[model samples]
Target: MNRKTLVLPAVVGLLAPVLAACGGSDDGGDAIVVGTTDQFVASKDAPAPLDPAIGYEAGVWNVLRQTVQTLTHIPRGGGAPAPEAAKSCAFTDTENESYRCTLRDGLTFADGTPVTPEDVKYSIQRVLDIKDESGPIGLLANIDTMETKGDKEIVFHLKTPDATFPYKLATPPAGIVQKDKYPAKSAREGFQVDGSGPYTMKPEVEGDQVTKVVFTRNPKYKGDLKVRNEKVELDLFPDAAAMGKALDDKKIDMMTRTMSPEQAQSMLAKPKDGVKLTEMPSLAISYLAFNTDDPAVKDKAVRQAIAQVIDRGAVAKSVYGSTAEPLYSLIPSGITSHTTSFYDRYGEPSATEAAKILDKAGVSTPVKFTLHYTTDHYGPATKAEFETLAKQLNASGLFQVDVKGTPWAEYRPAQMKGDYAVYGMGWFPDFPDADNYTAPFLDENNFLNSPYRSSVAENTLIPQSRREADRSAASPAFDKLQDIVAEDVPVLPVWQGKQYVASLDGLTGVEWSVNSSADLQLWELGRGRDLPEDGVQGEFEEVVLGLDVPVEGHRG
Candidate 1:
């Protein structure tokens, strides 16, 4: 499959809860088959070196969420961070610089080895040591060093005050791994490492490409939630169409990737007899990045003008079929501290105002610029998306647009090197927080490769916002941060999406493990002849997940 076939239409993996009806085989009592796009996996074949330190891909994180226990986890109920491996945790001081966690007693890895605070400290420190650029090491920006006080207690010393530290730990970046199985300085390449999560992968079934990897409930897992299915066979498909067809054929029970608007709409319209669709709001954002080094968009006025001229609502409706909504801020909706700063500053799409802004900057109309996007990385609608955007800008007579496409392998490196004058970028939150939106883009030498500068967001708002333990006070700081992003216009928020899944009728508890981020709790999935018309939410309880396999089962 091509890169486009690999990536889902929207951010496919994150956190979620809801209930629905779907039918499947109940022969094994509790066994379900899951179908997803192959590209979601960090490494196509197996979870080897499933080390969280180097595992940043959405698919990898999705699997890791079930296979490895973290210090904390955002509940499916969508409130504060709840304890996972940690029995109890809190900030030790008012400055929010020191965090203390007490490990739950009797915690053990898949091999039945005790999981201690020392292992927790090692898991975090090792990630920082490896420091893979493609990894989630960036999420641990606040930690200074970790201290293990006895076998049960651990404390994290932060270099700077960060109220969001606990949430960071809840992400896969802090997924605890077995110290003995993984080396301290290097990554455990392949599926050799030990994980203490809800389920264990059957090593014998692991393979490359479309091969199936079966996940069986970890008998050693100490989590409270009972596994709805004894086994979940994850089968990757080349594209959405293939995955959808398989779902209809009953070859697979569920899907994780986001479908194209056309596919989703068709699925809804046709209404398969035994299929039910469920939708959940997501924290994902798709936007355009202006390469500040490119002379065409180097000027803030030109960037701002493009932001003014581009019609997000039109693109959302025409291309995405309202599956995605216009997003005016980097911090997406459904989260506190989100603000529509771009809409406030530029109002609706306007050629007149765009022309005035360019004119005021002494730049002539009919501005020439190139827009680059990944042909297959974002989704099939990417081409239509940029084309619609080009039409909106071109029709205004304020700019002439030349749109281009590239594969993800070439596009990611190129965009980061400022090779593209302007490009499209999709963001999936590392954790559900406003800081994930700002810090990655606005910080000095951050994610965007362009030489775009925003001192207020970098020096003032971001730092101040991270320090504020109280979200209410932090909201105003984030509000200012969005306004600054609007003024600088380094990137433009095009749209925010809601997550959806299509499953056969008679399936129940599809929503039990969904946190605010759209991650599915596979353990919560099961089949039922009759389910509630008004879906019920799943209960919340923290449990330590065990590794996917026993020590002898690992194939390194």
Candidate 2:
């Protein structure tokens, strides 16, 4: 999804001065109101930010998950792909090149129209046909063609063996839309949804931006999910401070997506009477991406020199505080096939090593380039994070970097145009797999939209890893891919984040609300008994404050 930006509990002892008000809703209502800092921008250059074929960010997917129905989905406690719209799905060939699915009985769209297998085929084909550069078409690149039988069965023919195809189908990119409501050849503009998922969406728009989205239970939804609440109100804010204020004012029932590190630290230190904070593990990573085509950083040595000099620990500590951990690889720690290739190759932050690399390549010292970042997307701390990175680079006396900040609306389009020599971006995975980390960044048609490309990694190692049904067995290929990324220095890993959700004490299922991929499963939340001040009694066990809890069958 890119920071699209997607926190840790080890430094729990840290203290912050400011403390916000916290309490539960006194109205005792059945509906839930949640606050988030996620924003979607529609402009002349890039319109239809929420269209399944056009939207690719994590925030965009978060909204699509509740309204759009995919054939397969990751269950509450995530593992393999489970049937959602389809009754069942599996590979039909021994080579894993052919796959098939059968639709469930009486499946209907949100508008009460019957959902046919042709709709599934049409939705997928349109994404490939539109081929928007900023869209999720890259995820479906392996699909050669699709065929449907009558109204029930659908089959997919793949260009290569891909066991991960089911996981890819579980993503919002494969969200099934009614053929009549959505155009076949182009993206449907405006803020609206027409799918057969668990929720029926009603969006509130201010100009081109979606200010709020109201989700009510879809009676026509026939999926694997159990909707706990009748309605959910997702309130979008401009920044973290405003979201926190809404939570304090009791305008929202809970706050998710992002709470600043300082706020989390303060809440951890001082317990509030009716507020509970849950920290969940995430497969999200923030990194620095290089436009290899840009003149400022075209040389591999220049990229390598920046990689050697910048200190990740300092950026994580000073900017993020205890909410994050320094990452040294493209793949995060929890995922399979993770390696410390960058750390192993570069050792530590050293000016001498950076200078030596530049000198060896006959390049000039004090390398000058602009580092661009988004102002409103990741969080308020993003400004500080980029400034800290610039300080680290400048302190080495080997580089002179000018830091620039733009809102996500403009930043993303410019990034796709290869306007920035060095830019900051974050990724929340489409699924919980190492391939999600590798393929999206290193592939020929990468999500970064940068000129960076590795022929061996894209053509050989990535395809080799996907061929294995047992993902753990694919570690060797992924390890080699990580090594290639380290050698190329196209993107430098900065930090791996932990997901945190702050909720009222009267709310249930906070731990299970966000999945391993950092996607919100709001259907799990319900009104329940007032939780104890010290801990929450979850459905499975007692979850205490400051302790990591499992979300979707995996520990955070």
C-alpha RMSD in Å of predicted model 1 compared with the true structure: 7.1
Best by TM-score: 2
Looking at candidate 1, the ten consecutive residues that score lowest on lDDT are 547-556
Residue 70 Cα positional deviation in candidate 1, in Å, after optimal superposition? 0.3
| RMSD to truth, every model | 7.1, 6.3
Cα lDDT tens digits, model 2, 441-510, are 8886778876777788888998898888878878899999999888888989888776565555557777
Among all windows of ten consecutive residues in candidate 2, which has the lowest summed lDDT? 7-16
Q: lDDT of candidate 2?
A: 0.77
TM-score of 2: 0.91
Give residue 517's error in model 1 in angstroms: 1.6
CA shift of 475, model 2, Å: 0.5
Model 1, 171-190: lDDT tens per residue? 77688888777789887766
Residue ranges of candidate 2 with Cα displaced over 4 Å: 2-29, 529-556
